[model samples]
Target: MNKIKLTITGCLGRMGQQLIKSAKNSKNFKLVSLTENRIVNKKIFGLKPQLNSISAFKNANVIIDFTIPKCTLEVLKIASKLKKKVVIGTTGFSKKEENLIKKYSKNIPILKAGNMSLGINLLMYLTEIASKSLGDNFLSKVFEIHHKHKKDHPSGTALMLGKGIATGKNKDFYNLMGKKYLNKKTFPYSKKINFNSIRKGEIVG
Candidate 1:
């Protein structure tokens, strides 16, 4: 069987490095290209990282993205033109940006998820069930902790959980979204789903 040609964006990011390591070990994929927002002088896995562009992703059959929202959109534009498949692991997209991604998907195949882990997906499923079981009497809130280097408050997983809550309640995720607290000792839960994010240490979850 032929190996799938793969390209990874945000080559300097935490998820980017992890993808490179995993892709190198896996037999099902051949690492073809690596891209970053800025120029990376040194070669990684014998391939120099390039800026996001058509040339950077032209040779790949699939592109895996774990970058910021702006960078992810940039990659989508290039991949759409190239007609390349994409797996989006990036998060923190605004409503407008999410709509934009939906528009791009009309042109090419796109699989997007905030958290790609099987465990998280299961948790999201359970969350929805629990929210529905609990009904509207119980208010919902989300809390998350990540490595100090991680950016974006509430984390994507938290948002996913919030979405599950919204889904259970049969309401829009954006409408039920509440306050986002960063590094707060304590927060309150309201009618809307509040979120508290703690960033510290080197926790990988």
Candidate 2:
């Protein structure tokens, strides 16, 4: 079997580090690039990705991005232009940014998920079923954990879980940004995504 050529954007992140370790242990993958603001030039498993720019990965078979919301669009544009398969693991995209991603997907194979780990995916599925079974009587909340430096208030995984709850109750996303400003009753929903974010000191990069 031939190896799948892979490049990782946001390569210094937790997810990126996980992928790097997995790829090193697997016989089926060959990592060709590692793009991040930090640690881009570091060698992995004795193989250095000869790259000075993201465009160096033009021929890469797959590009997995875990970059921040600020960088997601620019990276997606590059991937679309190269006609490469993309796996988007970034989160916190605005409505306009999401529509742009949809537009870009028409040109190539794209798979977008806030959480890429198989376990998290199953959790979302189960949450949907439980939400449906439990019905509108219960309100839903969102919570998550990440490295101490994570900037987003609610983790992407938390929001994905919230969406699963909405599916169970059959409701659209309730933008919980401002309830008191708009008067809470204007949008009717018993369930809301309550997010709790934590930032603390941690040594693992």
Candidate 3:
């Protein structure tokens, strides 16, 4: 039996760098390719792995993307064509991009996540509890603290907190990050939910 081959996109980002490092350390995974915005040094993963030349995924069985939505869509298309399993960790997808993922999921085993943090996902569950029991009369507020360098401002964990609360209340439209907050107000918003973002130095979520 051969080890499973893996490819990573946005291999230059912080998380991408971490995944590559982990994969290099894992015995069951063989890194087949790396994708980046521009052609850079080839010594990624400290092994000089081959670069992924085909957007259609010619070199690996699985593809992981931690890039922007536009690049995600392109990678999704390529993964669909190659019929490779894809794990997407990119956050802040537009409505259209979300739908596109669903559209292609029928053909590929695509794992999509907002924050992809186990602790934060657990926190989402707790936020559900708060949303369910807390009432408008209680005047509850939700908050998030993240490193200033976080790619997704407000963090996907914060979005999940608001989502958990909405599910608890059994109603939507209760977010502090405006629907178009990223494009406009540049933050989450809720009259009561109050989604907040913290940007600071060396703070890890």
Candidate 4:
């Protein structure tokens, strides 16, 4: 049987590295390319990393991206032209950027998510149900904690929960968005959903 051609972007990052190990161990995928924003001097798993471009992704059947919003968009643009499928696991995108991704999806198949954990997705689904069941009298807020090294203010999972709240309310997530606070001891609940994120030593909850 032929293996699925796979290109992994942000090859040096934590998620990228994890995907590399997982993909290498799996029989379904053949890691054809690895990409980063800058040039990589060393070879990883026998393939040198390249910058995101049409040429870099031209030969792949699918591209899995675990990069920032900027880099993800760059990869999407090239992948759209190449007509390749993409799986996006990156986070921290504004409403406009999210819209841009939807636009690209019109041209090529794309699967995007803030978190891939089954438990988290189930939690998100539950949140949507609760939000929808609750009346307007109830207020909503989100809190999350991540590794100290994580840079995004509100983790992708937090945004996903907020989106759940919006989905329940039958309102736009951006329109319902409230202030985003990082490492704050306290935050207020408003007409819109608020998000508070705490970053410290790795906590998996």
Candidate 5:
């Protein structure tokens, strides 16, 4: 009957703030530490945010990251060294960086996902089933919309859907991945998985 000590990275970012609020309300976790890429002098929820370091994460049972790829790798490095479990919700990692994350997992337990929403996961599941049921005649494309401030095109959720389609087809995700279109009104569905991302004002779709 122990609470998990949690650390959230990029504590000033959107998801980081959301995680802090959610963790504050959760009974199963204690928010032990918060971290950012740079020095943060101000305190959030009675805890000062620190830069990613061994000292920052040495005491945490689990670390949740919602930052960019570089910062996530930094967290992984520290977490791997400290032997801490990590949950990654960051996106926009290149295939090479993705491989490096897998390498980091060899030493420490890590659970990484582009999107962690139940609805999104369910959508991915349904996409997989549909892909399998449709067979070769039907081509597939993933389209998504997000807030304008979000920089990564095709969004992580869109990519997740792409992976689901690949899984259903029994193809490698990287090999099956096709074009990524941003702010486009139209796109084509090829033999592989294609993606279209629409960025608008303040819509979390």
Candidate 6:
């Protein structure tokens, strides 16, 4: 059987490194390219990381990206022209950026998710169910903790959960969105969904 050619963007990030390790172990994929936002002089897994460009991704069937919203958009532009599929695991995009992604999807295949884990997806589903079942009698808020290096507050998974709450209430997530508190010991639940994010040690959760 022929292996699928793969390109990994943001190759220096935690998820990027993890993808590399997994791709090397998997029999279904062949890692064809690695790209970074900046110049990388050293070689990883026998391939030098290049900047996100048409040439970098031209040889791959699919590209997996886990980076900032700006970098993810850059990758999408290149992928759209190359006609390659993209799997986006990046988060913290504003409503406008989200719409931009949707626009790009009309040209090529794009699979995007806040949290890719099955367990997290299940939790999001349950959240929506609970929010709908509970009704307006109760208020909802989201809390999350991640590694200190993670820049985005309220993590993507947290936002997903918030969106779930909005879906249950049958309202827009942005309109239902409340305050975003970082590293707060205590926070209040409001009519609109509030979020509290805590960044600490290198915990992957």
The models' CA-based lDDT, in order, is 0.93, 0.71, 0.73, 0.92, 0.90, 0.95
Can you write out model 5's per-residue Cα lDDT over 22-106, one digit (the tens) per residue?
9999999999999998988899999999999999998899999999999999899888889999999888898899999999999
Worst 10 residues of 4 by lDDT: 196-205
lDDT of 1 by residue, 126-161 (tens): 999999999999987898999998888878899999
Superior candidate under lDDT, 1 versus 2: 1
Candidate 5: which stretches are off by over 4 Å?
Answer: none
Of the pair 2 and 4, which is ahead by TM-score? 4
TM-score of each: 0.97, 0.78, 0.81, 0.97, 0.95, 0.98
Clashing pairs in 6: none
How many pairs collide in each candidate, listed in order? Answer: 0, 0, 7, 0, 0, 0
For model 2, what is the error of residue 148's alpha carbon versus the real structure, in angstroms, after optimal superposition?
A: 1.0
TM-score ranking, best first: 6, 1, 4, 5, 3, 2
Q: Give the TM-score of candidate 5.
A: 0.95
- Candidate 6: residue 68 lDDT (0-100): 97
Q: Among these predicted structures, which one has the highest TM-score?
A: 6
lDDT of 4: 0.92
Error of 5 at 69 (Å): 0.7
- Runs in model 1 deviating more than 4 A are none
CA RMSD of all predictions = 0.9, 5.2, 3.8, 1.1, 1.3, 0.8
Q: How well is each residue in 52-107 modelled by candidate 3, as lDDT tens digits?
A: 45642686888989888888888888788878899998886765677889999999
lDDT of 4 by residue, 1-205 (tens): 9999999999999889999999999999999999999989999999999999888999899999989999999999899888999999989988899999999999999999999999999999999999999956789899899988787878899999998989988988988899999899999988888889999887763
* Candidate 6 or 3, higher lDDT: 6
